[model samples]
Target: MTSSFAPDSLVLNRKLPLWYQVSQSLRASILGRSPDASLRLPTEEQLAGHFGVSVLTMRQALKELEEEGLITRHRRRGTFIDPAARRASPVRLLGSIDAIVAQQSGEHTTILGHGPEPVPGDLAAYFPQCPQVVTYRRLRRDGENGEPTNWAHNTVRPEVAERIDLADLERWPMTKVLRDAVGVDIGRITDTVEARLADPVTAELLQVPLLSPILHYTGIAYDGAGQVVDVARIHYRGDRFAFSVTVEAR
Candidate 1:
């Protein structure tokens, strides 16, 4: 490994179970010593070699780590370290800054952007024919270095923007802006979540290895009228996010 390895934290002489010892050492390297919070976890094969163990044994240790909420695995991407900032969710996250922030505590806000790109055909299905609104994109992260954690892209109708000041958004979250400015109280939301491979652009921005997996969410927002008003698509670093939801079984 690079100079980021915390070799001092590792003790080859430890009497702990082999798997346990190897797991702790790997965790320390991935989370403790990496220069960047966005650094991706090493491949399992690499870990196995580092510990001089069979891949199966290395996997067992990684499995335990995943169960402990320390790492997440993506279909196309390998395992990743989940950031500890997100709090539990109130309901299914349908892709809103407030909803995401409810599961997190830190400075969060949207940056106003100028763009009226025609809504993609896939996303257009979520809204009716109308004047496409200006969209906003925000990259959110916490702690020192401002390591970008996730990118949130939101499309809002002109009516909503007309009543809200873009300047205020830089300081306050989108929900607070809507509720306080436009008198819209968000009651609930619905969304679809999926695992996706990182395109070259996303990987570069996130400082993650290209081809790594990222969490993808695409959905629409409905006001009290139950009419969809906005459509959003967001991608998050898979290694930096772990999702847990409670579902009822009938």
Candidate 2:
């Protein structure tokens, strides 16, 4: 029913399953609509065309929505939004690093520790020329409740680290510190998010139970010259966080 849908605005991450990504983007759009908005959805063929995907892929995405009760498809009547969708909880979708930092601006930060340390094995590839990095650890707590929400371990190139003050770590996100304070012209940031069971260290830091589910976020930042400047790994309490991405039609 919507005539203004702009498919070109939908950015799909090739790293993830195309169908799953499409479904999530659609899910966000459906849930974002007002209760008074039209409930009818475009035909599968039309949607596939809009999304630049095969009809089969679009159908798979719609099936996901149907399974979640966000939409109902009647054989010949087309798909309509489920009434329950209006009552569904709103999701917070952060599309960029700045948005993410702004979301946590009110959180209180505690500096756990910081010192020169060996490059972590997983991050070795990002810093091929360096043997060591400045490791900074911090914990973030909700400003309202003072409950711990996430823990971050950030490794910075020694040169970049030298320009950062320890006091700045408590006040700003690393990305901001790197760009604003260290004068690094960050060109790109690649992020990977996954679910993992909390280990002893992470469990204690996040105040969660051992083996409890947690969200693992890994970020690799590159400077304008294409050199890796920072690598960050953060553990967030799954209960306290939800990662969402909005797919704008226009």
Candidate 3:
């Protein structure tokens, strides 16, 4: 049977490892579909062709999916989507600032530590002219199962942080706290997303294996007057999250 997989939809990023990119694309497509035990995926050769990758690369991608329990392969029987895939419940990482804020509002949050600290040298560009920033570290878990999903480290201007109620951090996303409580006029937000290997600290906090692939997000929030207000560095467990984007043809 011919598979309905769309080759055009799979855009390859040459910078990243081919197998990893293909696997992530396939993972997203598979999860986006309705869970069907009888659904058969395209053959390895066909999928490789669709993704414009070598069969070996496709196999590697498929192997990763199998390890994650998202699919099962059988000799001479083709591959089928795992019925349990629905239970995986990967977070759909959206692009919009508002969407990003709304996505985390529903998650269960645990504050790890928050206090005044010097901004990291790497992030100094974002918080120009500021010697110190209020650092907030938090771990977010799935509301249903309490599974750790993301760890976020936020650095805010001391002045802005002072106006925010520490208690509110446990309940609302920082964007909301800054706007509503601190009265910062958020003019724009910039987000950069990338894939990185989990460091030792991140692995222990998120309870994932060291060096496992994870989603790294760096976000900068600017005030209406164009002053930077907050910089957030967040790491999401790869197995529990998938980044997605929507584009419209003008």
| TM-score against truth, every candidate | 0.58, 0.62, 0.72
Clashes of each: 1, 0, 0
User: Candidate 3 on 1-250: residue-level lDDT in tens?
Assistant: 3445442257676877888878877776666563332467889999999888999999999999999888899999998778667523444445566786875564778889999988889888878888899999988887845878888899999989889887898888898889887888999888878978789999999897666668898878999999899988889877666666666666
Best by TM-score: 3
Q: State the displacement of the C-alpha of residue 113, model 3, in Å, after optimal TM-score superposition.
A: 1.0
RMSD of each: 12.0, 9.8, 4.8
What residue runs in model 2 are displaced by over 4 Å at the alpha carbon?
A: 1-95, 103-106
lDDT string for model 2 (34-133, tens) is 4456778889998887777899999998998898788899999999878667432222335676865564343688889999998889889899989999
Q: How would you encode candidate 1's per-residue C-alpha lDDT over 1-250 as one tens digit per residue?
A: 3343322234453444667656655654454444444545667887787777788888988887787677798867877767662422222453465664354233554463656666656666555685476677766666435766666677766667677777766665455566566776555456778867678977877776565557776656667777665556666666566455655575
Best first by lDDT, ranked: 3, 2, 1
Q: What TM-score number comes out for model 2?
A: 0.62
Q: Model 1 TM-score? A: 0.58
Error of 2 at 128 (Å): 1.0
Which 10-residue window in model 3 sums to the lowest lDDT?
1-10
